[model samples]
Target: MIFPEGGGRESHRKEEIKQYYRSFLWSLVFTVPVFLIAMIFMYIPGIKHALDTKLVNMLSIGAILRWVLSTPVQFIVGRRFYTGSYKALRHGSANMDVLIALGTNAAYFYSVYSVLRAASSTDFESTDFFETSSMLISFILLGKYLEVLAKGKTSDAIAKLMNLTPGTAILLTLDDEGNVISEEEIDSRLIQRNDVIKIVPGAKAASDGFVIWGQSHVNESMITGEARPVAKRKGDTVIGGTVNENGVLHIKATRVGSESALSQIVRLVESAQMAKAPVQKFADRISKYFVPLVIILSISTWLAWFLAGKFHGYPDSWIPKSMDSFQLALQFGISVMVIACPCALGLATPTAVMVGTGVGASQGILIKGGQALESAHKVNCLVFDKTGTLTIGKPVVVNTRLLKNMVLRDFYELIAAAEVNSEHPLAKAIVEYAKKFREDEENPMWPEAQDFQSITGHGVKAIVRNKEVIVGNKSLMLEHNIPISIDAEEMLAETEGMAQTGILVSIDREVTGVLAISDPLKPGAHEVISILKSMKVRSIMVTGDNSGTANSIAKEVGIETVIAEAKPEQKAEKVKELQAAGYIVAMVGDGINDSPALVAADVGMAIGAGTDIAIEAADIVLMKSNLEDVITAIDLSRKTFSRIRLNYIWALGYNLLGIPIAGGVLFPGTGFRLPPWIAGAAMAASSVSVVVCSLLLKNYRRPKMLEHLDIGGIKIE
Candidate 1:
């Protein structure tokens, strides 16, 4: 539900992290003293001479002290690995836990046997390895602690998202006429639909609803990534978690609890985080058999070394005179098992996905799922929906001419009344423009429209104030057999030439006036197309507008291809056609009609201001609603996948080299070998390096295309 106050499960995870830290500290405490009392410290040149003398008996004192210190570290601090290993074994699987348990226990049991022999006989040869077992456990614990810390940083975006909502709300008590009488603060969870809430200056909204009274500027940067605060008035919708900058507002809750926008965003981000990227699936497939394979290799290494040591007369001269073939074989096997870590392979992708998703959320780019990020990187062709996408959705009244016997105000009222119920961007613009010129003292009201119907890709039809009113394009007029006058045709041609959509308003089958509406190109639309050209990506404009207007708009934006008179289904067909032509297509749109096309594209990119249906169908949501973010989404995906590839190479290469070395491959030729402690250190380093590399993605920034260029005479001011 995107609760800002973390629930019980999150608290439990925090406790688990604390437990790991405590166990690591205890292991370090005992491991330090055990190392000081064993051969590791005794082998130091100065210490070796002193220990051999009467001051301390190397065998008796060191063996007893190391055994006493190592026991608790092995059993208490390293207990989880044993339990985890047992669980994995019962399930017929092998994992990092199995390696840790096998390597540490082998050295520990052998040391235990040696200590028992030393206590029984004075002639017992010293073979205690308490330091090796203790140090291995300590190192494994340290690695886990670092892993836990790194994983925490990767999820900071989720934490920040949850922090945006306030815990409490000020519920207002209203009188009979819906005027506020009093208010009481209560838990935000208690808020319900239809409840009235009071929001003051500097207070965040408690839920998603409509403001019924008062006015304010709301800062919605957290949700939309827009730096400017949007002004909110009565009847304006306000989203939860946005700050009210001035004045007070009485809002009627339309959506509360899990239905709020913040909750949906959290759900989308969490689902994306949980889903695996395509590259990650390959790594997972490899890891399913990686551990069991490593175990078999370790066994084979031991057998080979043991057979070689006996038949080939022990390759290395550094082995102690007291050690036999069996001891050397066991040591080599333990080193091989410890050095071949599957942890590095398993961690390679999830860490990168987590960091990438987190970074995306922070920038207001919500990747719907990891699969989208994987696919977005390969998009080579982009198809853009014209209205409310490449251009501003708000259509302004550029030029108006009245024809038949009617006042200008009456013509506007008839047109606005027919379009009042529609949710279209052009309809909204006309309604808003009409409201400003309304002469009524009270709230603006238009006569009711009867038999209303909205024609998809055309316009609206209705009977306003018992008079037939049709407001739409030339197609709607032609379909109804309403002939346009010579003067009207000339006006329409001039309007189309000027890149304006002419809304032809008629009354009772006769033309009344022509309202020239122009939805202007969005700032930076041209620059975005220019950048895509430089990037070698093809751009196409698909719209329901007439060819002349469509072509004019496309030319201004630098889009080379234009497909005019396209319905929603035709738009999807265009995307499919592009894919069939061997192009990886990306569809950018921002309306309900765009949902089908969005889903049809290889990568569906929905602008943040788009309808909920469009956003749901889209794989990637650009919160800025800026065309430039299309480039950002693609670039970010490419960079993230690049990092994943590098991680795979590093993990595979580390295992390829280390496993063979730890198996004693060089011993036959060079007589050199990696010790057990050194092998453990290398395994830890491999896992940590993969995680650190993924973390480096947090420093990513968008390309500086606009900052470096001086376009014509206009410097970026």
Candidate 2:
């Protein structure tokens, strides 16, 4: 029932056919005893003697009764194969169902006619009446039942995903001072944009919306592939199907129905299922030739046996056994068809991808699809954006250099007062530093800043306490006709050598002191680079900052390659350059400027808590902003692809060894033949093996760095 009348109609049809086969299995159970009774009348000597002595004239009546009961059983329970074979033959193609329907019905009608003709003959035996038809029908039904169960296991992932969408929604109406009012309860479709929907604790959200008020943690694992619940506040987006951990939220719907992120995720997953893997193409090519070859060989086998009987000096007495030879050939051909099913070949790649994606979700790494997961394993080079990807993107005061005959605290106060109205990150750093060093009497009672002006890429100027205060770079000082003294130049050179942004402070047209500000590297950034080195991934940094600052941070993180002073378009070009050099590059960043580069890379991994543009452009978005997930994602892809290969080998290898044995290749010289029941059982065993192989992938162990390294030489302190 997981498949219904919709876009996935083919999947639904396949399930319906499987269920029909299961019903035939139940019919086979009921008909076994009837088959045994017919066999007893023909083979047992006592029963045959009694039938010949007392009811010899009634044999025609008995044959008619057998025909009446068994015809419905064959046509009704076995009608599925008959219809399928008819369709295949009409299209000039033959498959396993064609062989089963033709072989079994031929054996049945042959026995029926033989029994009826023998009623007039004086010397007649019913041995041929009971042997062929019952065996073929029983075996084919068994094979079909097992095939259904295995195919069900292969498609479990899609069924589980469909179960995520909730069946109902709660529509909010109105709230009085101390009372609640309820409107008419309606379906999810009636909910419109900007409508307030009340989500109870532990219930799945019905639509994509933003929280108007209240707080809770929502589990967005099904949509974003993250297992942990993310905390939501007012103005934060919530996706449908995610569970609310606690607290009620009055959410205003942003996207309803198919436009929601949850719906897009479901659509993506379903599309992945429809894609055929490379191994299935091989099976399709092989099947194109397999059916015709089997049919020709079966005809040749019958002709060879019939001609040999004629050449051996046997007369009309050899006619019965010659007919038996043709029946045997038909039986072998049917067995070959049933045992060579393509279930494993089709399931190999998709099952591994489904499980791999699920495992990645638990670790907070979101992979878009099978292609992305496959390509991630082969990435050789990693390029990074500098502002938010490498550095923390927050400028801070790193050092304070006092000029000759200048006080450090006074220098900080003047700079802070001059930048009081500035909004740049650099300005905030100076103000925060002044606040940290503030003293009761040391606080400057400067007049309110006036005519504040900011020079792009330089600094700010303001009139403080009626004195012109300049806090800017060297260029800003020269533009204002303020001369930098010998002491100020010496201090600026020292700050530049330390890879710091030098902010010159001048009061009343004279240089006072220098303030150095720079964006600090993120914590554990160096360790992340070292880990990438251990994994053999080449790391490079690209930035819009000056060459000195770029190289300074790159050296701290142990990265040797740096692209300095790059604009947004230039950063994307650098990614293309790395890719042109035969490297599968991955760009990691967290800013609007990095969007183009993120889209151009082989794998775009966005650090969480970044700009919305960067996150949208990335293929795999890291929810925790931890660099370690890059290694985790690559390791996951490698393991997943390895499993897919193993499954394909096992599935194809089993059919290669099975089809020949089912064709009676060992029959002529050694008088050996594969019984139909054994062929049915072997087919079931092969299907079970494929399912078990897929399930074993759930136990794959993700590689950990600590397990393979010695950290004793690296001091943790």
Candidate 3:
């Protein structure tokens, strides 16, 4: 029933269309009987003989009855075409509505004229005239009804999206004794930030927030398109409209009402559905000249035939046939107008986009709109943020080197004491490593450390076990006048070559040991790079990490190009540089610092785990933070565009082939002329074909990737 195609809503739409058809049928039932009764009275022997055998003399009863019955039917069924024609005339454009309005009105006025003429002629009959008026009106009404039904079906996607958001929110309040009180509320405005909201299993989340207490598994497939339910725990954020599978969570609401994720998604889908694609613009241009051309052609057809008749010297006796020829020309012109509805042309692109977006949503990818989806298909270069995009973004100690014959426990204890007070991410990594090693029974904690001071761009220094302990890079050791041995220098060089950071540990003016820390590459990172390579898309990595670490991770992920040690703004500049090189770039990242870069790229895709600022800055948001969705998004866009192109071709081709035939272009050569009913049927078939083609998208499947590919070429571990 829905214009474009999909299954679930089809039944409901068919029923609605049936209801409209039933109403139209009842209207026909009432009007057709009256029309027949009026015809009988005007044409019967008794009535005809009483009126001096003249049909026109019986007009007082038949014409009045016909006008009374047809007036309301015309208003009910013909008003849409009338108003549409008026608008088209106002704008100096012609469309299908103009044809319906002209055809139906001509038939009605012709019937009135015939009735008047019949009253003055002794042998005339009203039967021939009344039937034409009734038939034309019925045909036009049927076409209008079909048009309404098709339009309703095509726009159902937006309605389905709007139905996802909940109508009410649960407000949590505190009583005098500080005990919580929950109330089911209808107003979203009553919900505020930091309020504990209880969402039951199988119910949609009222707002976007983080879980404060309890645990549950939420089905975010509505937003992410992942069929599996994601396990939620404390500190994890939950999106609105996602179903809660089990358990109850007291969520501290972070976003409410229109600010919720569900509201934003609904707004995006609605706007995307309303936006037109490139092909529709062509149809609009064609429509602008359609009416004027038809009028000129119809007039010329009448004049050409009349001129030929005069040239043959038979015009005096053939004048009535010339009028009939003009009427036939007018009928053909009207048919052309009525049969060339632009609804299919206009809907071609939007319907494909809507279906593509819905498919992407079901797969955990969120493309902002048709524009973003379209642009993604054209992306030739894909730039990625290194830390969170390729690497795990969490540093771990990968190697340890002893410089002064210090025991492993003693080295770790001293370093842990020195780094425990530091707030840097790398410092925390070292502290955590030391904590795990110190937990062993053989390793004991050192005495309390004091006077901790962190050196910017270097490392930290502190008094551990009553000794001045330094834990930093070689620069920090030299700054404190601590000597580095030849062995320590060799270790640093080897670690640096492997894309690892070396934290130099020195105590009492002597080098002790070094800790090599590096972030591990994410699983399947290399495969994603190879896939891009096969697709002919260039892959590059930008990172704030040192060049050594950047090159190391880049090599591991099969990335040949790397931009190292870039600040947030510098990352955006890199995107601009890529654009200047004439490559359409798609930036992918999941960090706050990547927001500017994301905005600078032609298409920005943010991973779901990314900060809100970064997600907001990007054009597309990937809910699973999986690289596979990037490829899936591009494929979906390409397939959607291809489908639209196919549908547009089919719709335009049908009109192109049928219109000339309908206009009698082939009559002289092949003796073929398209009847009005045949033209109408063909036009309907074209619309239906476009809808069916769009619906076929439901069967489209994502491409499958081969498993168990080796990554040794990139050296990823």
Candidate 4:
């Protein structure tokens, strides 16, 4: 899943940096003498006297010394460029290596010819450019050394995550009666499923497990991004890599190794770095043609310069000292080829994405990859599911009313029996409320229902004590031919108006009672909607609740668009409708019922506390399940893409101005020419600059406005 279109080449980057450093050392050792002999040493009176001595018919001692020192640098230290060029050409393409090989070889082989021709002829005083080729390779290697060093830094977040796991765990041996027999320290990686482990104070959890024998506060800020430590009692699951703070706890391991949350977070961040962004196609297409086009341009520059010089198109003073038309033309050609870079363009996308995704992971937002990050920035509309997304999701019985003559305890007992087998939040709410009527509060026994049937978006039906009990909304009561009386209708209306769901109980096909349950809006829900509006993103609430209750909650949250009583399939269809209208839509939800909508939206975001299916279907997961993270995800993506755009501009701008200058485009007017070695250094610098620009995203933080809210001109920090 690692989309490597722009920059995510995470393979042996450290090794490559080491190799570049090694090659640079070799290049420096040989190239320094060539430069010294040609430039500085030859200018000295004593050195000039010895270097000017004729070694052959016309070749001087300086020429021979420079050639011998530069030969190893050209053929040994620069050999990698040759191999890379051959591989690129064999594959019917070209790259930075091809340009480096061509430019340096042109200078070196021509110098060899000049030296041989001077040795054979007494009158021929040849100017050999042995220093140009050797110096070019040295400077380029230095640039690569710095570039690889920066590339290695972009994945530091993942490295930190991997380091969170503790090395060892205290595994406990339990007897048949669940009493601890013995405890021994073992490697954390050796822990298996169903093993009991003891975590002392301040120790990190070795595996994902529920507390079995103790209570303590566990700090889960690594996963949830919350600073507060959560209280963990028996049956509360603790994530691996989280520190147990106050008390010792015995835990039964549920997930081990890579199945643990910390490992999965690392894998997801790695995958995000690997995936390619949509805009990377622009750089990719340009790169495919960039090298060959530069080669052709190099040949044209040489031809133009040679033709101009041969026909007296320019003044004689235009040529540098000891260089004629052909040699002058050769220098311009080498400069053009050396200065044109493809590496900068290739790195413009992936590096920024790596840093951006890593930053998101640290803040409890798990963006799938470049595609999701790209989509998030452009989202103009967002659909929110009400129950678990904007509301607390945990419902409680706030009120209970009786329609017929029935003992309240007997009535709750029957309702609790029918709901005991169901896993819905509302069902659990009723069962918990009914527990007060039993003498054994902790372990209450309920009457068994003969046949229990649970209906989606409505309620449950069961046969309890020879009575046909139906518990659900008004639609379910009518579907079973049960009529709602005036008093029941008034109560249902009053409950819905209060933003509470009304569940009716029908005993033996007659209406008996109504249970009013309410799930309060999540904290900062209203502020989140207002912030989205200020960001120019429309927020809509979609729920399966009745219009009255849905509208009441939506009004409180400052949402204008509400779609109530929507089935699972209908939610997805609504997302399609928004997309059809040319809007980029994002769906935020937290249940298995929200999976379809999550998959259908342009960017699907799921609450981390939701069902597994919802998380799997989502493109982004809000690990904290907080409303503020939605804004953080969008703002982060926008900032990351802005950095990417800046990279592209820097890379492309460098080439557009560099190629012409190196090719002698300004020589006719200014009488100034760029050297081939300087051109090679500029090419290397361009790539390093692009990578450094991407690395700057590592310092990114969520917006200050998000951290401190201003609602109604009052600051809420």
Give lDDT per model, in order. 0.83, 0.68, 0.70, 0.89
Tell me the tens digit of each residue's lDDT in model 2 across 100-199: 6655665576666666656656555433333344545555565555545544544455555555667777887766551337745557766788777888
Candidate closer to the true structure by lDDT (higher is better), 2 or 4: 4
Error of 3 at 220 (Å): 2.3
Query: Residue by residue across 521-625, what tens digits does model 1's lDDT show?
Result: 888889989988888899999987777788889999999899987878989999999999999999999988788899999999998887989998999999878
In candidate 4, what residue range of length 10 has the lowest lDDT sum? Answer: 1-10
Instruction: Give the clash count for each candidate.
Output: 0, 0, 11, 6
* Tens digit of per-residue lDDT, candidate 3, span 1-717: 111222334556677678558656855864675556554554777764553332345444555556667766556655666888899789877877776566556556665675676567765544323433454555545554675565554445456545566766666665767466655665555677777777878888877899876799999877766666889988889997788999987688998766777666666655565566555667678667765665565445445544554565233443333134444444455455545655567657777776777667656677787778878888999999876577666789988888677678777888887787775557778877887765664344556889989764467888888788888777677777777888888888788788887778888767878789987776678888898889899999986665676787788889999887677888899999999999999999887778889999999999876777878888788887767677777788888888988988887787677666666567556656554545555665666667667767756676565234333343211
On residues 1-717, what C-alpha lDDT tens digit does candidate 4 reach at each position? 112221234446766888999999999998998899998987899999899899889999999998999999988999999999999899998898998988899999999999999999999888988999999999999988998788788888777777778989999999999999999999888999999999999999998999989999999888877666889998899999899999999999998887888878878888888899898989999999998999999999999999999999989988887899999999999999998877899998998998899889888899999999999999999999998788888889999999999999999989999999887788889998999888566779899997899887778999999899898888888889899999999999999999998889999999999889999888888989888999999999888777788999999999999998887898999999999999899999988778899999999999988887899899999988887789999999999999999999999899999989999988888988889999988888898889999988988887776767653354533
Best by TM-score: 4
| Predicted structure 3, TM vs. truth | 0.74
Instruction: Report residue 216 deviation for candidate 2 (angstroms).
Output: 4.1
Better model by lDDT, 1 or 2? Answer: 1
Give the Å error, residue 375, model 2: 3.6
Candidate 2: TM-score?
0.68
